[model samples]
Target: MGTKIVAVYENGVLRPKKKLNLPAGTEVELIIRPSLKGLIKLFEGVEVKKDAESALNETRERKLWE
Candidate 1:
């Protein structure tokens, strides 16, 4: 079974927001994914050359309907 938890990286360590129910010295794999809020903040105030509809139409014309 796999568990999903939110964690923060601090001082070269990953600190889990909540305590885990695992024994000491337990090994687990980590798959890191940024949160939605984090992604939004990452691209905040970024400029775009074209609107969404225009971009989609261009993509359809070049890729789908070509």
Candidate 2:
């Protein structure tokens, strides 16, 4: 199962903003990408979450069949 979640890189670790549905000790990989603050601002007053989720879902689907 693949999913995307937000986190903060603090000190020397990445802290998730919310609880995750992963089993204990389940090793996970990290693909760090910089935050797009400017793009977000350009879409100000719009629903950013839905757009981001859609983009991620599309990418995941494409990668799954690759």
Candidate 3:
């Protein structure tokens, strides 16, 4: 895991931004930490319920295809 790969924490999982050449079920240690932007986003305050609800109700899916 020496190669640093950036991933986005979407929903409740880390989605890698690039293709990985690893096999399935590979047990690797993960150092879960927030990026600078993510740390700053924490102070963005509560999102509006209407906006949040609308976003959640959308039909579009989020996929990690890089």
Judging by lDDT against the true structure, name the best candidate.
1
Model 1 steric clash total:
0
| lDDT of candidate 2 over 1-66, digit per residue (tens) | 688888888999899989998899999998876457634664567543567789667756866322
Give per-residue lDDT, candidate 3, residue 31. Answer: 76
Residue-wise lDDT of candidate 1 within 13-63, one digit each (tens)?
999999999999999999876676765775578665799788667646865
Model 3 clash count equals: 0
> On TM-score, who's better, 1 or 3?
1
Give the alpha-carbon lDDT of every model.
0.78, 0.72, 0.66
Candidate with the greatest TM-score versus the true structure:
1
Clashing pairs in 3: none
Q: Which stretches of candidate 3 lie over 4 Å from their true place?
A: 44-66
> Candidate 3 local accuracy as lDDT?
0.66
Which 10-residue window in model 1 sums to the lowest lDDT?
57-66
